[model samples]
Target: MKDLDTLKYFLGIEVARSASGLFLCQRKYTLDIISEAGLLGAKPVNVPIEQNHKLGLASSPIFSNPLAYQRLVGRLIYLAVTRPDLAYSVHVLSQFMQEPHDEHLEAALRVVRYLKGTPGQGILLRADSDLTLQGWCDSDWAACPTTRRSLMGWLVFLGHSPISWKTKKQTTISRSSAEAEYRSMVAVTCELKWLKGLLLSLGVRHHKTIKLFCDSQSALHIAKNPVFHERTKHIEVDCHFVRDAIKDGLIFPSYIPTKSQLADIFTKALGQRQFEFLLRKLGISDPHAPT
Candidate 1:
């Protein structure tokens, strides 16, 4: 019927092409957010959230206006689609939208200030011959101060390009770091299965088993070894599901060093050095950065 032109911009996301591949960013939308919040000229920060600073309800003064807080956080959440660096911070701040405190509002503003520094920062989906499905999953165990629940983060890469990702809180309280990591592995496994099926439907042939990486060796052993049955009793169902995937040759779980963990950026706040390093590793860069 109608053949639309190639996508340039859709729903606030700007798309650009280069000899390398595609770059997606929300520069205009990010700038509008800063201007709306009256922080256009505000000082920029290196990272969105301060390390070791845990925010919770009743931690600071009640915000004068709750509506503004909700609106700001909602917009930031939408912006995270193209800016994975903002996912952890936006996910943290969105929790207090109902009755945000002054500290929460300040934290949200700090994220906007960070965005001011590199509004053009976005994901780079490079063109590659490799079509292998891979993923990195990580968890911050009991990072929440109030509930003591853990946070899960994952990134699914088709060859070198990150296509799907998530930063979310786990539904259940994990007893130990290993358990938390194992649960994250389960989540990523499910994502891999769906992604593989989608590729098949699109007529993309991938015969190799998807490889999943995690920094936790204990989690890897838990998925492969039946000896940890006692310790994994609580999560027995999850264990079987993951083990079955490995057995059926659908996924292959492996270990990665902590420093090389790509999903760490999604689970917690980081210092400037490590944060920028991981950002580069994740293929997030601003072509407009000072030369």
Candidate 2:
């Protein structure tokens, strides 16, 4: 067995440590993707995707090369490992990989261009984090124009640093925004439970109830209230664990205003100002950005 020196790089991710925190990035990998996408000389955009974009309805000509679009989006999936801010953008782009069109390709390139300006942006695990577990969950009702399905996004934090995040579509159509938001709460609750188990296995016992925040007051009421109303009768029985978790003291439900919802970045394409504002709340930064 060979003895390796201090950790530096692994699996295309670059790692660095300092007095402040441990930083992880894919600067080389990001640059390679941008250059291959032919956006190395392109101007950077403030946001990854356009606001209120009808990407699902884009009717532009089919891309001349579908393979290129698939390959580019595939690379982005890898890059997103350390770039939580890219989660929503990559999710939206990957959907069109099967039959990518001109507009789809252009949107994928916009993501690359956004990365061009800050290739070194990545996760920072602070040295002095408190290690408290918490999470934010959100949903965009009927976000899919094709299927009329909802989209959900969540971000779980181990202390101030994000450890896990995801943006996904609901399998079933949600009849109301509250239903969509409640479904998202259920999804994030499951994630927080698994994370707690992982921490326990690491000898970090978290006795306190994990906090899970949502912007929907209706969903919070549904989870906290034991008696189900006829309005919520349609929710799947198996998904009711969210209420059970609250009863077990495993989760503490809280309310947050929509404008301040950190999970908004994962659910919808936002204007530049709102997107940048939410990114800051997620503890994401570009330490490598020019001063």
For TM-score, the strongest prediction is 2
Reference-based TM-score, model 1 = 0.97
Please estimate how well model 2 matches the true structure, expressed as its whole-model Cα lDDT. Answer: 0.90
Residues 1-291 of candidate 2: C-alpha lDDT, one tens digit per residue: 976887789989998989878888899999999989888899998889998888999999999999988999999999999998899999999999888989999899999989988889988888888778998999999999999999999999888888899999999999999999999998898899999998889999989899888999988888877787778888847347887898899999899999998998999999989988988888888788988
**lDDT (Cα atoms) of all candidates against the true structure:** 0.91, 0.90
Which residue pairs come into collision in candidate 1? Answer: none
User: What clash count goes with each model?
Assistant: 0, 0
Q: Candidate 1, 258: how far from true, in Å?
A: 0.9
Off by over 4 Å in 1: 1-4
Tens digits of per-residue lDDT, candidate 1, 61-80, equal: 78989999999999999999
